[model samples]
Target: MSLSHEIMKNICGYSRAKYSTWFYYRPDHILFDAGEGVSLALRNMIYGIDHIFISHNHGDHIGGLPGLIKSRASSMGDITKPLSIYYPEKDSQILQFKEYLDVSIPKLPFVLTWKGLRPGDQISLNANRFVEAFASDHMGTLSLGYKIIEKRKRLKSEYKGLPQQELIACIKDLGREAIHEEYHKNLLVYSGDTMPLDVSIVQNAEVLLHDATFVLGSDREENTHATVEEACELAIKAQVACLALFHFSSRYSHQQVKDKIYEIITANNVEIPIHYIYPHFYPSDFKQIQIEN
Candidate 1:
């Protein structure tokens, strides 16, 4: 299967101006952000989430953490599964939120861990896969974007033209390790609530979920979220394989969002598949909207 299909197979979320934003990637058991409706929308799926990555401390971003923790402790789902949540290091809002969770849900049925991560920090998902955090430009908050990477091994370029018999001989003489090198492949990138930043950070990602909080260019505010045009420009510059725009402002109609996205793609001659999370649709329905090339 394609990397996009594997990573986004059961992904679902909702994002609108001042409402909520959350994405659940079922394949990796990873949840990005914990907005208000997460616990209710995800329900039982919450049990499968092993790691939660918080982008910032905004209420619309981390509002559902307390409910999620409490639900996991009391719900019928497997309560013993280990869960780890990573948030921006040194952010007072998240620190205060954690304290609130502690006070509200004093005891839990499973192991709950909270870690502070800086822009360059990494969390290993498994032996071959990991997630990395990068700084994002979201107003004055300490926001972050995340990249999911898969490590792969490939034969060295020098050995590409060698005959099969010669390659076998090389393996016997130099050992397999000398003939192959490991490289990292970016599977997906999630830009949680941010204005335009360096596109190079997400270069060649199989899928990029970016903030497109504004559709009308004139409605844009300073040092805030990205406009639909800006999001597409970033995706184009980064050369990402697929783009999934989210966090649209509620002022525009669903038809408006679609029309603007189509207009931008046409103007730029963009060829990659594009998808967006419409404000009026439920998250479950959002997952059904296919991305077309």
Candidate 2:
């Protein structure tokens, strides 16, 4: 195939204060976090996605489930592919979800799968893609983040001049599986909601969606959320290609949050481009702008 960037499609990640709703497209299908008004966004993005990933059981995280399931059923979606949900089987939240699925969406024409995730659990999604769920610092209930990645051989930039036919021949001679064993890279890491911690689990991910709720002491320790400084510390430590700061507290204005985060990360010599997810309450554009460097 010709060299082309994957069609990236993330419009919004936060509905209002402290809410997450995002749309991400991998090579296979679109993905999203369960949140209020997420169904409408998903419909606008792609026809019913086969896979849906939820971060936690907070109201903001799961409040959208009811509507989403109903909409799909009402729309007459023929979900031949099973909808797989990767979430931690914590408290009675699963029971609530089940009740919603049973009563609200009593006629689910699709198969649904659920699995209890723990630290070090790796979900090999496809031939060359994998998602790893690790322990997040967020408490109150079980919360998790995901790392999307390529588990195949790296393409050397030095081999650009070689024709594809030649490369195919070389691969055939050397055995494609043998070459795939070397040079794999992590592509993306998403921290649903968490305090600052070492993000080495997703080290070098091309994209990182991390929590940046507090900007200079916006919240108390009773509710732990990472400040801009802390978020940058984790990003700088992981050395990811890009950082998408999200889950902002209701306190800061859009400009105030960005300005505060940009200033601190810059001062600390954090060089990776930082992106922000605008809350729905903000009238500003949801377009996430990144730094030049």
Cα lDDT, model 1, residue 132: 97
User: Could you say which candidate leads in TM-score?
Assistant: 1
lDDT of each: 0.87, 0.66
lDDT of 2: 0.66
**Every candidate's CA RMSD:** 1.9, 4.6
Q: Deviation in angstroms for 199 in model 2?
A: 2.9
- What lDDT tens digits, residue by residue, belong to model 2 across residues 42-112? 56333346666667777777777777766665564554445676776564686677666777566576676
Cα displacement (angstroms), candidate 1, residue 199, comes to 2.1
Question: Candidate 2, which segments miss by more than 4 Å at Cα?
Answer: 1-12, 30-32, 44-46, 76-81, 154-180, 281-293
In model 2, which range of ten residues has the least summed lDDT? 1-10
lDDT of 1 by residue, 111-183 (tens): 9999999998999999999999999998888999998999999999999989999999999999999999999
The weakest ten consecutive residues by lDDT in model 1 span 284-293
